[model samples]
Target: MKFLSSLVVLLLLFSCQPQKNASDYEADLIIYGGTSAAITAAVQAKKMGKTVIIVSPDTHLGGLSSGGLGYTDTGNKSVIGGLAREFYHRVYMHYQTDSAWKWQKKDEYGNKGQGTPAMDGENRTMWIFEPHVAEQVFEGFSKENELEIHRNEWLDRESGVTKENGKITQIKTLSGKTYSGKVFIDATYEGDLLAAAGVSYHVGRESNATYGEKWNGVQVGVFQHKHYFNVNISPYVIADDPASGLLPEISTNPPGENGEGDKRLQAYNYRMALSRHPDNRVPFAKPENYDPARYELLARVYAAGRDDTFEKYDPIPNLKTDTNNHGPFSTDYIGKNYAYPEASYEERKDILQEHIDYQKGLMYYLANDPKVPAEVREEMAQWGLAKDEFTDNGNWPHQIYVREARRMIGAYVMTEHDVLGAKTVPEPVGMGSYSLDSHNAQRFVTAEGFVQNEGDIGVHPENPYSISYGTLVPKKEECTNLIVPVCVSSSHTAFGSIRMEPVFMILGQSAAAAASLAIDQGIPVQELSYADLKVVLDEEKQILTQEK
Candidate 1:
């Protein structure tokens, strides 16, 4: 992910002229964002005999896949096919080799993946791994495809996309470089490129009435996870006194009534890759601007006789884990990032740094602070950041798990009914079976003065259902040539299920296949026949139907 004077390359290509022709850097398909979806899109485009290039803003290749989300959120693996399933099959193959297992023995690791074998013998799939291992697998895929990736090239949000007659002909980067393409895919979690091209997208949650969904908007009463604080714990700065101002992370505003719409977003946390082994552990360092007062709510959680903590330090391979948010005040910095989806690059960077600093400080406080429970502090001291992982970025994950962001309101919107098997979708580009899992979107002080987490729901889909091809393309009139695989067209509730990493890669492959066919037949992606698109997807081994 190291930059190789690519900015200089872009600057020279533009020649400070402030403008360039379409022929400056041309490709048949240009994929934006350096996510894992972007990797598969470029690879699939190459397989379809199209010249592909990745205009990547990230130096790191994989998004959340390589960003310590190693304990993959795979639901009903039978529905997974194409590049998405193949990635896991390759992960299984890697574990079969001695060179792949460095810190743990295969037999010692045993076999434990969500109620199924960690290594599925019949399917040749692996569902658990380390962060570094996943990154290596993605890097191997990039090298095998021999794809061109322009790293650190950010999109110029203002006046970047060049369009003619309702189609995007080319896009310009911030460095003044232009990339012309017949088709473009926006695979970023933020959907920046899609938005820059004048594609209409929706931010925040839509009301249940908007999509007739069961769980779409404000969910103040539903409590699915243990993220809610104990009712006995007060939210004031001075335990029971409202006269003292609100605590550090507590919101003073009222949580809306259930089923109402709001601008809140799910809590974001680093999926820390922690190592328990002494050889690989890097002791959690106190971050700059450390503030013990920042974790006042966390101290209250411990003092309330709540001893059961650390339930979400999910294990991966090699004595490491994909550590995530646990209790009421663990790693999730609640109600902090509502503006990130629409923020400028500089503004977004500031937000991300704030999150990084907050998380880092939390780790330090847990291991060393006197206020944290002695039992929890002792357990926290046993784990530290992996010394071998994320070597360049101070052994921390580079990509924050952006669970949901600017979802495009395209030709068709996938809803909760689509996921729960009530609405039947005819155009199947891919399939998903994950639960409607949404973290607490807001943290507010209740009527009784106790802090409570709201908007956390975890309901499973009734059956494995197909994702519509319509979700990948914008409305025909907006921008016919651009495809969005990651930030799909879906209700916030449905996006909670479809936003998983596997589905992103599946959508990426399908996007490229459809793009290739559109170029061959001289048609817009929206006008491309579902029958024809299905043919290519089937040939590429995409699972279009549920297996018996």
Candidate 2:
């Protein structure tokens, strides 16, 4: 009887050792994002004959590509080669068929139809499309590659799992499921994976003295755009009267010492998705806490007969517009999102909803309020929420424009010298040509007591500049096993141009290629020779030089 009992215990112990099933868990690469870059990286990994999976926190596949802002910012489109170009090509293909335009007829819409290719096949530049069409193109890529995707899987960012040698052995989700992989790419805008891996990163603006950059922080005297007070607009109940109580949105803090540093972050607002389709349009509804007093400054502007209030509704596709924050007081929820960078998920959610309410309420006020100028109200009424888009979230954008977030202090720190055409980089992975664009950082009382905005830089890049691989790699001591394509280390000004979506896609593909090569060559990603990486990038059709 004792011998039989020991035999049973041995059988159970042998069965308890978990066997690796062929289908249960396995992959050559695991990507942690659902942004456009994340999709491109996963697709590239699969194309290279590696098994890959995308674990995204978003329910949707494409990030801002589908989340409105479809009016692409493709500066130096020729530099956008590789998978990024393929994405636009696919968008062109989608519109080639007449059926793609179901709502509007091809002849009626003419050459300017929805999802139509803005790029001449030979020109190598395209920068316009519909939101749904961008989503469809991303979907097509996923389907053609047959990539495995798990959406809405938030990473257990704090102490969930790790290996002894700084490798991410397993990443558990909020639901307690674990995903293990040999190689990982953090394509997220937040750099959550990279931060969790103990990588050094920075939130808010960095001091100019830290990097010797001209446009690093506290840009008080530099007003390059018309976003601030061209003419004094009062924030008080009585125009130019200081004793009538302070204005609702104006910040009381003194604009920090010029060229000095502060913790102020660039403003964030929803890139509203609106359409003219009468059947599909949901007219802006008055928000629950709609206060007419919140828009008193706007009314003051209108009362002063500023006719340019509606000029900011930039066009997108199919009679839609990617409306942005324009003028002194617009869609930007000033002073409300200072803590968004390191905020928890629940806190972030609250911030997002607050922005939604503020923006929606602003629209409702413009369209319905009798106090608004007749011309402004008429123009506002013409535009409404795009009835067919973002069906899940009530026709509003799902993602907030996180303009600047936790920037990884990586191997290569790109500074103003690179963007100002003063110095050239030795190793180039991609190129950025957009101006050093940053929206307002704070709204303050001007010298004369009227409220004004500061920190809006639109300086053009002196020339097309190259992005280095060092910008993607972390310090060896920080984390050797991670690659960060998004949230790369750079001077605040340089990052402005590199933050575009197409550039992110280009970097994503390049990061994946480097990761695969590192795995094959048995070396850390930082140790891989640039010559070899350049060869693969060139062969893969990635544009490395402006002259090319």
Candidate 3:
């Protein structure tokens, strides 16, 4: 009797404890990352009548779209279709409601510069919106479709993925949860899932010679945007004194040869949601680790006649602005995020906090520091973080703008030729029309001893171009079951245009459609018939080609 009672108690205790290694949760399709791409992919999979799960690394969804990039960088809006268009349409519906406007009246907002009305009632699409509104739209998709979203679940990059015959079978998270799926989509900005699964990827810029392109590598003198120092400014702490050492944020190393390859990545920053509305604004508070001296270079830039601090404070609805990096010294923490793509989770956290601290300190320096010009300071003081946005994150953007990261070296590499409309793509998946825009990769002293930024390139494509479906799938031998959307195979230069949020959402839907078809046909994702894929993509209203 005593033995029997003990056995029953042990069994009860085992049952009560949660299964940490549970692989019981299986889906026909699994989408990773909490980006706009992830949301669209999951929705597309569900619409195709497949069981799908979104294993999201973020507590919040929609990545930069919901974070703070509300002022869309849409080069050509005509090509945006499918779920991507639906997302903007929902934004239109939200703004149509009179209750959506709180701090500003709808009629008072003048929509300009987008070549069309921001609120396009004819097409039922609104291109510009608030960060919170974007989040709400993404959340609505999840709620309406009854999608299974596992939030804050990070992929254990090391020893987490289980493979069989070069195909991913299961993935485990650091939180000890395992997920099994027939087809997987890596929709992260960082490409963590694809990298962890042993897919070939490239970081940093490749040489122009390697890709046979004009803008693939280092562009020492290229200054399309006003991010480079035009006036002669000494890089030393003391003007014209070499022994005085380099100023803060200026690199000491050489800027590298023109067209040469280097491991330097373009800058990244938070797309701030700030408002001038007094009742709805939170004053820019100095971070706990604030150091005003860190922005000495910026003060010097102001003294040297650079006064475009507020130029890129692009406005969104409700009197808010989706502020981005503008001039020579601004929000972009250039050359600081080189190691972020491959860094360990703990290291990445430290890097993330550093960015948060740097950006927060920048705001404080601009708004309150005595070194800033009086007029500029006064204008900056009027702009504060919107109280209604990112309420949980101290009124700051929750996601950092990871401009570029680990790009896959997959089946087809999209190059400058393709983006420039010089070469037509095969097996078209989606379209991209934005300019090839890359932020400064480094800040270094020029041969003439003046400080200048290098690697900022902005060359507009001749026209809207189609993206290859081959860009989304790995080589058949590497991983047959996985698909990558956000980090599609592309040269660094071409990725600049394809990296836009609308393009990402477009690719996401196409990737999910492919995943569903591959599962149904019992074939590898790489082997999916393009003709059949095109039929489904057409039915889903995905814009595949640019009709002149």
Candidate that scores best on TM-score: 3
User: What TM-score do all the candidates reach, one by one?
Assistant: 0.95, 0.93, 0.96
RMSD of 2: 3.3
Q: Candidate 1 residues 47-84, lDDT tens each? A: 98999999999998889999989888889888888998
Model 2 worst lDDT run, 10 consecutive residues:
108-117
lDDT, candidate 3, 91-118, per-residue tens: 9999999999999998999774366778
User: How far out, in Å, is residue 133 in model 2?
Assistant: 0.9
Once model 3 is optimally superposed onto the true structure by TM-score, how far is the C-alpha of residue 198 displaced, in angstroms?
0.6
Top lDDT: which candidate number?
3
Clashes of 2: 0
lDDT score for candidate 3 against the true structure: 0.93
Q: What is the full ranking by lDDT, best candidate first? A: 3, 1, 2
**What is the Å distance of residue 487 in model 1 from its true position?**
0.5
Clashes of each: 0, 0, 0
